[model samples]
Target: MRLAGIHHVTAITADAPGNRRFYTGLLGMRLVKKTVNQDDVRAYHLFYADGIGAPGTDLTFFDWPVGPRVPGSHDLVRTGLRVAGSDALAWWQDRFARAGVAHGPVEERDGRAV
Candidate 1:
């Protein structure tokens, strides 16, 4: 059996407005959809993606009131997104710096420049 790449990822966020702003404004992802959660109507479900709303590039969020996660071995910690090349990485690093976005230094990981 073979596995294809990711179609989308769904995560929860306590601050929908901030999340939307960061993803759309800062990172340049598109807001593909804004809808209510199916089972929980009060909560919002937001979909973000690349241009034209492509499948694999999409990220979904469940807007809910929540607290900081308790760090543990079993829980998910971070999400890593990719760019095209080292030049792009440098450009993003500069952009982040100029925009005052807090980020770690860009370094090579697993033979790939990030």
Candidate 2:
């Protein structure tokens, strides 16, 4: 069978708490699950999502104590969220500004906001 859209995205975070605060507190996601990494018992695996934690909306992270990487052009380019309309985009822009979160302007990319 062909694959549908992305169900979730997972990334590594050196600070789980900060990640949680940024996603859940600032971006208004819910903490769907809080559990330890099964393979590496000492670390945490966090799942954040929209209000009810729907499958396709899940954004997860693994709390590995990795040191910071030097800023380079070759790293993962960007992570984007698809907001429903221009209103939602404006809301996010305002929210990010009020929360002191750095964010670039919402611009049209391939006929959609990115």
Candidate 3:
């Protein structure tokens, strides 16, 4: 079978509300859906994305406010979004900075300034 594209990316979070605030409020992704995790009814599964909650745009999180995971045992991961140009990166940098969110400096990547 062939895969078309990524449907979504899901991660575990220690705080649900905080995740929602960052992803929706700061990042400008819409909170498209809010539901409970299937396996654990007490926890939440939050979905955030661009307009209309389209596939390939979604970033989700499963709430588990219990304990912190050991870092070195697992690979650290980061999510990247494609911006149009350096202008977009600058805009995003300003926005993030205004919101007091720390982010890496914009750099060139794969022949494009990101």
TM-score attained by model 3 = 0.86
What are the lDDT scores of the predictions, listed in order?
0.89, 0.86, 0.85
Instruction: Please identify model 1 stretches exceeding 4 Å from their true place.
Output: none
Of candidate 1, the 10-residue stretch with the lowest lDDT total is 70-79
lDDT for each residue of candidate 2 in 4-111, tens digit (9 for 90 to 100)? 889999888889989998888788889999999899989899998899877799988899987657687465636787788989999999988998888999888888
Measured by lDDT, the strongest candidate is 1
Candidate 1: RMSD to truth: 1.7
Cα lDDT for residue 44, candidate 1: 97
Model 3 agreement with the true structure over 48-73: per-residue lDDT tens digits? 88977778998888998756557786
Q: Is candidate 1 or candidate 2 better by lDDT?
A: 1
Task: Give the residue spans of candidate 3 off by over 4 A.
Answer: 66-70
Clash count for each candidate, listed in order shown: 0, 0, 0
Q: How many backbone overlaps does candidate 3 show?
A: 0
lDDT string for model 1 (7-31, tens) is 8999989899999998999899999
What is residue 16's positional error in candidate 1, in angstroms?
0.6
Q: Residue pairs in steric clash, candidate 2?
A: none
